[model samples]
Target chain A: MNAATTTRRESIGQSPRALPNTSSVPPRSLPNDEQRLLARLRQSDEQAFDELVTKHHGALIRMAMGHVGDREVAEEVVQDTWMAVIESLDRFEGRSSLRTWIFGIMIHKAKDRGVREKRHTTFSDFETFDEEQEDAVDPSRFHRSGEWAGHWAFPPQPWDDQTPERLLASQQAVQAMNRAIEALPVTLKDVLILRDVEGVEAKQVCDILQITETNLYVRLHRARERVRRAVETYLEGCQRAV
Target chain B: MAHDASQSVHEEITCREVVEWTSAYLDAHVGEDRKQQIALHLAACAGCGAYVGQIASVRDLVRLLPQTVDSPSESEQVRQAVAAKLRRQ
Candidate 1:
């Protein structure tokens, strides 16, 4: 009945746990093939385990690398993640695809290991960013107010190679892009690898990374922009060589 | 204050806002009304239009590229190791 007690109870009612599950994201469906694999995995089928590892191992290692930023530690994380996956097979419901669920576990384990190793930078650990600051573009392009205000001052440089845009997907360019992706900061790299590289659904990525859709959007755009710059640089160098 | 991209900046969405919404738009996650706003902005804003086009191509290039960006193979040994580890569990 006291004033302080009443206020405390009201605050608790407004806490995140008290909030309704109003997330717009829908859980990804487990494909029929994935269900069969999940069943086999639960029964400890060796072939099923091997197949899953073969499919996911490389991407998982790259994902772990994003968390730990070290090859050896990342490998260890992947190994530990596989162990966890195997042990928890029986507990998996068909809610999300097996891959997303596995990533959910991997990210959690990776975060813990990264934190212990002093590399896990949660949101509070870093400064906030204006997701659309246009840092790469010149400020003089836009005027204060007019018909053209808040619009492009000039056309952006063509991202495609001058030689031939099709050649942008050539082996050399992909190799350059790969290096660029590897060099990105952890969060950016994570979003890029998962959503862009592995082609996971954005909703699934949000779940795995435990970030809001907005945060994922920013990370993905920045990550893609960074890789595009690297590719553009490579193409320009190639042009110069010719 | 206004709803048109051709009109004054009373209620125009900035280039910055478009950039912020770029990924989500590409993912088809933005609402229909906001999607229309972006389309209007792109129609009128050449700079933002080019920016959007370039970023979209980057996404296309990425999709065309291989899945694994580094150490492109998951090596037979690694798979075997994982299987063995799981077997022991």
Candidate 2:
């Protein structure tokens, strides 16, 4: 790993306050293409702004949906996020990737809108959800007593034929995974969407969510486990039907 | 079983601990000591291997799944709105 990644990994157990101020520290220097894009955005190039919105709007809407009541409200939140992005375009230093900055803004607005609407539980309430107290895997899956007590009682069956392409090819599997992701509590959902679905790096994800690496992995593992369970269930049903 | 001997020899971490560490292990985020333990356990334990494989699949599949993009008109509308806001500023 590079020096930056090494530093991020070493910061794992440090308190958030003990970590360096990420806002003051740009995660990395912006890539040349991103720098060019930012310059065009600042120049009031409508096409450039359009490109930015089109690129991120879908992701923003999907992520916002995780926070709020419905698609309409999610759209509103994203629209507001775009306006905020436009307003702040000039002020955006290359501290974070534009994608990271845009996501950070949308998450802030989405949480605010989610609170105002009261349609969903807020992040503060989720803070009490207690990552430490929950087991990502079902405890029943393990034995209760004996030498192998903590070992798998019913280990996951191998998906010999399953691949990413094949899994997505199955409509039932796709639906199952989407439902599993949609059903996640906002805390788990946020990390999963950003880290797994959006393909953000772990460090950038931590930066976007203002979470520690420890919390990010905890939440991300839970999220992935939930989806894995969903796919497992779907596969089991398919087996039974055969 | 073929794994029983190695399982007993490398009993420092259980399948339970392996399950918890799967994501970090897959991401290479765990410490070298813990990483070695988990790697040895995974080598001996078929259950943990399958579980880790499934989680890894889930991680890759999530990004590969089709994203829901906005309709063209909706995209046009957002573009216009953003353009208008940029002009107003």
Candidate 3:
């Protein structure tokens, strides 16, 4: 096996079980640290609150930006979310993880703000994409009717010596990925941001977005494919210039 | 039509299917039976192998990219606001 394939295998081995049978498993409880943090926050401990905000603020802003389309507005939405969290802290039932609850509140506020601004598309607006009908990768990349039907007609060229560090090192490539992510429909964008960008677990992402695991995977794949396509296009352009 | 026997043997799962399942496969979400099919296919098909590897790279790289940053002053402003609100309550 090639080095890339070996790496892929090892990575898969290390992955958390992505699709747990939620029905069979008990609902997740707050981790002890979160429980202690909640207790401290309830006691009006400024340090605890500060740590909470610091931990989640950047991701909240990024996620809100995906919905509100303005950094300032996104920041405001997150601020409002923090305010809501404080107001509702005593009422928090621990039905979900604290992070999930916090994110859920931010998404609610961001979507409302997004609607008021009318600059950003809401999740309902994504109905037009028809998730069932859309193929994440371009169909033309696959072969037509033949023994090789459904095989790659135009397979992606392996990126030479590509590593995350190498990919991020390229200013143009980074911009390409950022643009691609920004252009995604909000539904796709939410899953990517929550699951990949923010490192939220698969199950919590579903809770935050009110989506099923199946829905999460579908949207996540499509989102990643778009970013991958952006990088591929950028690399192809670089090759052509060379 | 002549084809490589090694490639043909593993064509039970198509490249299109593998591409679609790439994310789930990388996350180890697929069923064992289907996972074996994909693994067998990837072992033989360099195209699918490259495609999956790129998608994996993209997934890992995205979180490492510089995300939206709140200026230190802005963050402090937020902290102060939250602190004040907590004090009031």
iRMS, all models: 3.7, 3.9, 4.0
- Relative to the real complex, the DockQ score for model 1 comes to 0.40
- Candidate 2 regions exceeding 4 Å error are A1-28, A119-128, B1-11, B68-71
Model 2: pairs clashing at backbone N, Cα or C within 3 Å: none
Evaluate model 3: give its lDDT.
0.77
Fnat: each model in turn: 0.48, 0.74, 0.79
A1-242: candidate 2 lDDT, tens digit per residue: 22222223222333322244333333347898887887787777889988888777777887888777577888888888777766666556566788887888788778778877774545543333578889989899999899988999999988775466677998888988988877788888889988887788898899888888888888899999999999999988988999
Off by over 4 Å in 3: A1-28, A119-128, B1-11
Q: State which candidate, 2 or 3, has the greater TM-score.
A: 2
Candidate 1 achieves a global lDDT of 0.67
Q: Please report how far candidate 2 places residue A119 from its true position, in Å.
A: 5.6
- DockQ, computed on Cα atoms, for candidate 2: 0.48
> Which window of 10 residues has the lowest lDDT sum in candidate 2 chain A?
A1-10
- CAPRI quality of model 3: acceptable
Clashing pairs in 1: none
Docking class of 1: acceptable
Please give the TM-score that candidate 2 achieves against the real structure: 0.84
Residues A31-122, candidate 3: write the lDDT tens digits: 77777777777777899989998888887887788777777998898888888777666655466777877887788778778878864545
